[model samples]
Target: MKIRFPMRASVAACALCAATTLAPASPVAALGPTGGGPGAIVRPEATVPQPAVLYGEGTQVRLRSGAHAVPDVTALSWVVADAASGEVLAAHDAHRRLPPASTLKTLFALTALPAFPGGIRHTVSAKELLGIGEGSSLVGVVEGHTYQVADLWRGVFLNSGNDAVHVLAALNGGWEHTARQMEDKARSLGALDTTVVSPDGYDADGQDSSAYDLAVFGRAGLRDPDFARYCSTARAAFPGTEGTFQIANTNRLLTGADGVAPYPGLIGIKNGYTTNAGNTLVAAAHRSGRTLVVTVMHPQAGGHAVYEEARALLDWGFAAAGHVDPVGSLDALRPVPRGATTGAKPKTAVVASTGAPRPAEPDWTQTGTIAGAAGLGAGVLLLGLRFRYKRASRA
Candidate 1:
């Protein structure tokens, strides 16, 4: 379908004129202690802090004895999940809120990609590029030009371009509208920690997502054929006056940049970095016909920690695929107006956690692969902590 996107100049002017808008805030008093029953959503986490492995409320990864060579990455939050089943194999600080950087684009793709056909073309305006913040990753586009929806998407996936995302958002309506829609999509996917504010994932105050939520995004994005194709693209090119502007995929796991061996089953997802967010990544890999998705967020700087950390998790997930038990499965979100769909599984509720440090064990009692808990001044909710409202842009 052919759709008209907003003029760049007008969009830029609107961006400049904007004031700080508050997020959808929930009443602190209305939130009860963490725990849920049938029809409840649960997000799990570790109460006692672990330095390396994920220690949240969900099931733990079971590595075969003498099979543990995974590096301890400095990333603050990360999760490894089986792609087909959405089962979380292992995670560290999986539910902690952290800057998402470009990985949030996976969410945008989930919400916006299937809306526009690949061949659709739109004019580019100088003003549109202005809407992207300074130091934001860009897929170079000239103002007063035109390009196809596919090209814009290529820019987004290959280069982590804020410019490409802005143009696409304009096609969806505007930044404000697209942001709200992306967040709504996050809700439907059972990504409770995500509060999207920018479609391109530019770092913004109050913009945040958890490692587990990112895995949710990757899983949902991969389900769409177009999203999977775009992310897996190893290289893409855009038309330009001087010449064809070509770029390699930013995902090193796919392209093998920085000397890291290209993973055999690496699939494209997305990756991002900013001062606040450090390095973040969402990647999926297939091995022996089994697919797994790994999300690593806020890794400490220096080497390719984001990619390496993700690589380690992927290796472990493939090795541990069937041998160990799943601590939890990332639930497909129940359709809103809960149970509206026939045979849709009811959102399961989790009982409140003790909120104390303890040894990690199978989450048999947590109820249904426990996921989110609401904030009560720092008390950990055992599972889905559904907040009434409140409110990812790049870093």
Candidate 2:
């Protein structure tokens, strides 16, 4: 009798074997004990252990030991924050305002995610595609194409498709209304210094924000795994009239030798560039269970330099905060009592009360008693004077 296992089980076994084969070789395995290869048994690198809680919402990472150094870049402003602790590790004029370029898409994603559901279908119109003008890059979304909401999102994020953004905005509302919504959302997220003049981050006067605000917005965007996956993709395909249109991610860090390597634990946020903004980058790197967010805006050179700087900062943060967990029980820390300083005089207490109550009627009863006493004193004085006058006449 022939016995067979389920097809799913067979497929799963094959997938497991493939995964094991694809695992990276370890350093020790690559360099054998005696520097000979025939007897060497190779082993995969140990996976970096992640913290139980990688990132706490709104909490920044604390730096404990590593050198805190800012990278050399023309970035008008920048910030490196711990994604877990919400602690700002390093910064350079982080609040200084600058044009965000495509980085503003983070806000767009934040606003659009809640409005559109996954797998929702939307029809692209000719009017929506028209008058987008020209830009650094586009996903080339054709007019009159009906696409799913998920595909449109991939176009907006993976490809920074300006046309895709316009279509999304038009579907939600017109550009003006969409822009207002973006601004409102930014404000609600505590990005008070940010102002979005355009739905897409095209070169428009007064469409600007600070590096600190961008870091905050980047963290919020990363909270959504869908957005994170889209941002991290190096390339994506969308159905077109002729065939599937393939678009390369504008972010160079996702691909090539210049790109950020897939270390133990790595997740994507976003990267942007413009003449005014230079090569700006928002990178989130996770290692040894800690996640760090590095934002460099307007770096002097290209994206590669910004990536290198960001990587260095991440390494430093990991080393610094490796052992200490300052925020573990942050609630227990409180302000010290006043006058508790050594050699300081103890504070004196003074009794105090609210002002004296006003008299209801100026004390009318007291006025009568005062008036009677005055009249009696005057009568006594007059009698004494009369007696003195009578004595003077007799003498």
Q: Could you say which candidate leads in lDDT?
A: 1
Local distance difference test values of all predictions, in order = 0.73, 0.65
**Which residue runs of candidate 2 sit more than 4 Å off their true CA positions?**
1-68, 257-264, 322-395
lDDT of 1 by residue, 166-267 (tens): 888888888899999998998887788898887788889999999988998887777677888899999877878676877999889899987987888787
- Cα RMSD to native, each candidate? 22.1, 30.3
- In model 1, which runs have C-alpha deviations exceeding 4 angstroms? 1-71, 332-395
Alpha carbon deviation, residue 135, candidate 1 (Å): 0.7
Total clashing pairs for each candidate: 34, 10
Residue 146, candidate 1: alpha-carbon lDDT: 83
